[model samples]
Target: MNTLLFCIQNETDAMTALVEVLGQEQTALTQAPSLPLMEEINAVMQRKNQLIASISQLGHTRKNELTRLGFKHPETSMPEWLQDQAQVECWAKLMKLTRKAKELNRVNGLLITKHLIRNQSTLQVLYQNHGSTSTPSLYGANGQSNTQRSTVRGFIAI
Candidate 1:
């Protein structure tokens, strides 16, 4: 019982740390790219990895405890092993925190994707000639056709 409580606390702390780090990462992603910010991103990434590993370890500990307490197939879930209201509350809180962390991570991923696409577009514009005959086209989010070149208003003489 005590072990389960401790595991829950550890998992929650790791999850909270993950949420905070991901928020910091999102901020860093939006800021102007700099050496110090890059270093901070790297550091935050390392911290995120450590927190994930710690949470995983805590999960394993809880599973072991549940299994020892005669809960069948503890790997499946924790509800089967929840013996009291306190355990139920702990499990609920853990689930909530994990959900929040996942959402933040997803938002951060989108931000990174936007940055990557912007950089790629900038490089393409820099390396390619603007007056080139070939025009690249893609669809926008609204399903509208988007061309790299501007449309000519008047017909040109042959």
Candidate 2:
């Protein structure tokens, strides 16, 4: 609870810092050719796609800004440290478009993974439970011996 409160306070303080960073980054992008900008955008996008794909392959829909940008999630549960979110805000200062780029690689990665899963019937096979069954023992559930008492091998008409 304290951590959550801290995050809220920190965000309020950082909001102005974020806006200033964006302003500076936009100025830089305006003066620069798009090739490098394009590349950065592409990188962020790739990471986004990768993060999504990773989660999807895990059969889940969880992603953090850090994960989208190739950073690992710090925990196994909800509200995972908010590291990715912070990372995105940081990168946001560098490029508004990079923020968008983070979503691209993720898209590409997922598309590729989806195709592979489809072609191999992997979706059907992924959830398939396959294994050899053990032969049933000649004993009852209560540990009583199951005697092979046979009256006749053939059925008699009553």
Candidate 3:
């Protein structure tokens, strides 16, 4: 019981950390896109991944402890098994944190998708302009003869 509570607390802590990282991700995603901001977001994502893994491991440990406590199917039976007030409160807090983290993650994912769509639209426009012979080439020297003109059409299929 004590071990299970400890595992729950650890998982809760990890989830809390993950929520904070997700908040950072949300902030980064909402800001103007830049190389440095992208790097920071990447770092935050890595930390978030680590926290998720840690939480998963702690959850497994909590399940094992529950099994040792004689709950056959701990996943479904945990609610019924948590009779003590402290354990119940801790489990409730953990669940609340989990939901908060999940919501933050969902919002961040939407923001990323929004950014991706915007980037893809920009790329499509650039591709169209690059392929059009009528549009003046943005690349190449103004006066010098160039053997090959770099084209973005090849790079972006869409």
Candidate 4:
């Protein structure tokens, strides 16, 4: 029981760290790119990886504890085994943190996709302006072919 408590507390702490890193990642993705911000993002990524590893270890420990307590499928549900109020509360907190982390991660993924599309558009414009045949070929949105050629002959600098 003590081991279970320790694992729960460690998992909760790791989840908290992951949430902080994910929040920082979102901020970095939304804002303009900068040296310092990029540095911070890299640092956050490393921290996030470490926290994830710790969480996984704690989860394994938790599974073992549950199994030792005669749970046939420890991974299925820990709440059913938990009788202590404090342990149940800790489980609730861990679940909430997990949900928050998932939400933030999803948002960050969308932000990254938006940034990629924006950068690709910018590159396409720049390539067209340069009037170079060596410019990257792009596939049509209809997904038919990449052979579609642009008809615009004049370059307009913005």
Per-residue lDDT of model 2, residues 1-158, tens digit only: 33433433343334434343434344433444467866764564455445445434332222343244454652343344445665445434434443443444345456546555665674334223322144334466888854533222253212
What tens-digit string does per-residue lDDT give for candidate 1 at 11-76?
888888888988899899989988999899999999999988888988889888778877788877
- Per-residue lDDT tens digits for candidate 3, residues 42-85, read 99989988988888888888888888889999898778778789
Give the 10-residue window scoring lowest on summed lDDT in candidate 1. Answer: 149-158
Better of 2 and 4 by lDDT: 4
**Please, what is the whole-model Cα lDDT of each candidate in the order they appear?**
0.80, 0.43, 0.82, 0.83
Arranged by lDDT, best first: 4, 3, 1, 2
Candidate 1 TM-score over all chains jointly: 0.75
Error of 1 at 138 (Å): 28
lDDT of 2 at 88: 44
Q: If both were scored by TM-score, which would come out higher, candidate 3 or candidate 4?
A: 3
Clashing pairs in 3: none
Q: Looking at candidate 4, what is the lDDT of residue 6?
A: 81
In terms of TM-score, which candidate is stronger, 2 or 4? 4
Q: Over the full model, what C-alpha lDDT does candidate 1 score relative to the true structure?
A: 0.80
Number of clashes in model 3? 0
Select the stronger candidate by lDDT from 2 and 3: 3
Give the best candidate by TM-score.
3
